[model samples]
Target: MTVTEISRLALYGYQIPLNPPLPVGRQRITSRHGLLLRAITDQGEAVVELAPLSGTDMDGEPIDGFSRESLQQLQDELTTLQPQLGSTAALERAAGQTALPSLAWGLGLLALKLEGQLTSRQPRLAPVPLIYRLPNETADELVQRLATLPRDCRFAKLKIAQNDVEAELRLIYALLAARPDVRLRLDANGGFSLTQAVDFCACLPKGSIDFIEDPCRESADCEALHSALGLGYALDAPLNAPDFELSPLPGLRALVLKPMLIGSPAKVQALIAAAQQLGVRCIISSALESSLGISDLAAFAAQETPDEAPGLDTLAAFEADLLVSSGKALCLELGQLPLLASWEAGC
Candidate 1:
């Protein structure tokens, strides 16, 4: 067997526009921008891009946290490890450090392994389901977009917060009113108080919501919120804790996993196993990563029976996604999001 090693890492910037602004509470994002990491193999022809999740700032300002400085530092560190490790397994072991470079290197090695097992000349990849952030003014516009989507698209997501509970409720009502058959999920980003979250859940029209995600900040309170509303809840931020333990919340129906935040595929698989044992739902979502990251996520999602819809529809979050939307579905050819032509590194 020929042993290949990582040779170089290149970072690129991308910006992609959204059809409508993505709003979470008062924040509205018009475009998506982030950093891309490309890893060159010793084979010289094989390359894999590693994109981590870095979304727009509080004011919906686009900022690339995966900067050139950070990427170069990560690359240099990984290059130094290549001689000692000499194999992907050793690199995977080093990934436990929780450092950015280690995480990037781990992801790069994983991607390289995936590239080696090419099942097809052109791999058939699924489009990530996007959850549009609807502004108060054009909330109806989002509904219209959802209503127009093809019947095959069984999932859509909405962002909500405690500040404007009534407006969000009204938006949800309008969406359900427009598309009675579509499945709907909500993400509050832990924006609501326990009391307020309960009230909001109570106000929701019965069966209108599929599930509510992280209505409150804490996992304990998340369980409480679920009990109070007598509805299913999903955990997001709580699972990102480095030393987090799974306590098995009764009403908790799902767990949203962002690999960038979790930092390891092993951890993700562990969470999935725990969630499965506890009868909790599992969804693999994105943190506004580029196609490189999205490709990894899509592969993960495909491998699971996601209980709640995964938050993989982040293509619109970037100014350029390597994939394209074919009606309601995303088109991926050879791990590239074709819609984002501007951000194509190797494809």
Candidate 2:
């Protein structure tokens, strides 16, 4: 069998406007910018997107937060390294030396797609948390939104650190009462200390929450809370930590894997296998990429964690997208997307 190789590389840049401007930390992002990579092989062509968070505004000032690198950084690196990336193995080697996780993730997907690994799979629905938007949204409004959720929606996520614990509790109770069949997933994003996390978890209705993600800054605090209250916890920010390890930590219910933040596909797959061996669930999530990126994520989720519903309820934020229409069930075609730059071995 002839070994397939990347015969050509085509790069395109896109700017998808976000209505209402996405709020990240203290910065507000008006538009999302990134690169689309199309890798052609003897078999066919595969496309992937590398849109980092905190993309620059019209003033060229980075929004600051979420992602470490900017879209310009990825473009520069890929342009300089385009010649050497002729195969999946070469891309992996290049990614191992790079500091950009988003680039590696995009290359990984492209490699997987070219190798016919990312086969299309049925898309699953993820509950959009009512609390992510509208900081001052009332419990009644939240409950009304909860009632609007699809009948088959089995899980919902909520942001707890944004609001006071008491007010959040009332909203949670309201959501539970309104849709008793749907379970709740709470994420603190490591905004709380040990004491505050404990106090907050103490007030939660027992057996109602699916898990609390990054409840505390310290892993020891998470373990302590789990031991004290037996509330399940999920690891999110810790996955990005330099010392991250997949252990069956006390109260570790799941691992929230964001491909954009995580390294390459191989590295992510290794983590998934190791995590599964420890009997922990892995939930593939998104960092608010356009429909193109989300389509790849859905394919990845179906290929890797078929049973778990991914946290991909983020496409609703984009004002518009390129090629594919906006939504979860989307598949990107290389011919459909516009191109900006191209390179080939013989060209």
Candidate 3:
């Protein structure tokens, strides 16, 4: 196995200003925050790794829970791994053995970048289909918002909190009435109890809805609801669970993966393999990460599963372009590395 010596490590915090504060759950985000990692090797090679922050357990927390305060902790952890690097295995050999998820992720990505460089089989970029995002608004308002969607749009996803189930159902019907050709994705974010979830499912026509996600907090509750209703439902946040194993719910639709929070590129690949074996769709979704992380995701998807349209249409939300775009694909733009290294992965 080829081993790389890590001679230096640097971490930087970057924030992109947001025009209007973006809201998730009950909190508002005024800016996007992420960590840019620079790994310099003893071989005089420098690889910039991007780890975007995302998915706050609390509404007000930073993305990925990799906050400003956690910087010191990350520094401390990555410091310990310096010894491992001096005698470390190349990413392919030690991928499954990685202990720290985030560090392993950053390093694995760097390694992938390097491997593509060495082998001359740099990753390729493909146009990813985007789900037109819909707001959790009134029926009339939603129809009005969806009308502005581009003509080629055939897929869409809506954020529904289940506060007013009847009204939300009506909105779904109204959306289909307006654009019946479009398939739908509904995210409830664990809003209902098992009974409530089942009742809500009962209100919908069996063949109308595409997938309803996280209807309740418990896996058993979601499984029971899917079994009872005979409708496809998705497990979104649970995909980040440690040592995540498939739950095999009866009406399982798709597995949503957030690569930043999911941590390791190898682990993400493993999950995709598992999903493929089970005949399940692995949808690579963004947790509102920066284009750096998004580029990471796009590169991974380009190689692993390029056919699926990842839930990653969030470039417009950013104030500036962190990555260069070709056709419809996003890729890294590393100045320190070659102009080629940026496009190498997306080549």
Candidate 4:
């Protein structure tokens, strides 16, 4: 059998503007600037885009807690290590020494792609169920965005902990009442008090919510609230920096996996295995990376939990899709990733 060897590695940096700017927590994400790697192999090529949340927001303010890993580091590593990364085994070994989880993940995926092990089942490129993040804005603007929701849309995720509590509540009520059949996920980012979380969860008509994420900071508080309401919540920030030794919690409905931040590809696989063993659902989401990141993200999510929609509606917020070599702003569907990568690679 002919082995698909790594013939070349191409590194790139891009800053794609975001329209209407996604406001998550305090950051108004106006643009995405990150590093990507193209692993050119005998078979074809595989793309990996790093999704670091530490980039500056639209206001040019630094996003809190971004790691020290930068674009230059990834490029330098690829350049210095190019000669050594000639085979799948070599790339797999390289991933362990790399400090940046995103970089390691990229190499790991490239190896898998070249070896024809990226997927075990099929050659199909299908769309994952995506949950749209409702922007935290005025009631009128919220109503307008809500109006665009597809008739068949089954899930919606919203952020809370607002200055205008009444307005936020009104929007939540509207979403719940309007689409009783649709399950909603509220993310407070651990910024709320237990009382506030309880109040917010209480407002929901029974069975309208799928889960809440990081409602409060303390696990004890969250566990108590879970006892009170019997509603489950997923851990986001906590899971990002996990020890991978967690047992099942009563209210841990799911673990939102961010492949880039979670360590090497092996670590991500272990985390998923652990979560599945605990009977917890797995939801893979991106950190707002460009085409490279979203491409692998959709692949990973589809591989793990294709039926459950990952949080990938962030694609709709971009002003331009930098993945295209022509650099035109076009519709980016999951199926178009390979073509987009080839275009970017100028192949």
What TM-score would each prediction reach against the true structure?
0.75, 0.88, 0.77, 0.83
Q: For residues 1-347, could you state the per-residue lDDT of candidate 3 as single tens digits?
A: 35565555555555566544554533556676555655565556544344434434335564432222243454565555444443234444344464545555676776766444323222342323333233454558758666667666656777676347787778778877877776777777677789888887798765657788777868668778877878888877777666568855578878877766566677888888888888888777775666666666676766676667677766665675554453333333444222211111101
lDDT, residue 98, candidate 1: 39
In Å, residue 272's CA in model 2 sits off its true spot by 0.7
Model 1, span 98-144: residue lDDT tens: 35632543454455443463222211333425545444647767778
Candidate 3 Cα outliers beyond 4 Å, as residue runs:
1-8, 23-27, 40-71, 86-100, 117-141, 323-347
> Residue 131 error for model 1, in Å?
4.5
Clashing pairs in 3: 53-63, 53-64, 54-63, 54-64, 55-64, 123-345
Q: Can you write out model 2's per-residue Cα lDDT over 1-347, one digit (the tens) per residue?
A: 12368889989887767765665533457777778887888778877889877556545676543678777788888888888888877776776667788888887777677777787774555523434554466678868888788888888888777657788888889889999988889988777899998888999886888999888878679999998899999988678653577877878999999888877887789889999999999999887778878778888998888889988876666776555675434434556556778998334
Error of 4 at 225 (Å): 2.2
- Give candidate 4's error at residue 38 in angstroms: 1.7
Winner on TM-score (2 vs 3): 2
lDDT of 4: 0.67
Locate the minimum summed-lDDT window of 10 residues in model 2.
126-135
TM-score of 2: 0.88
lDDT of 1 at 166: 80
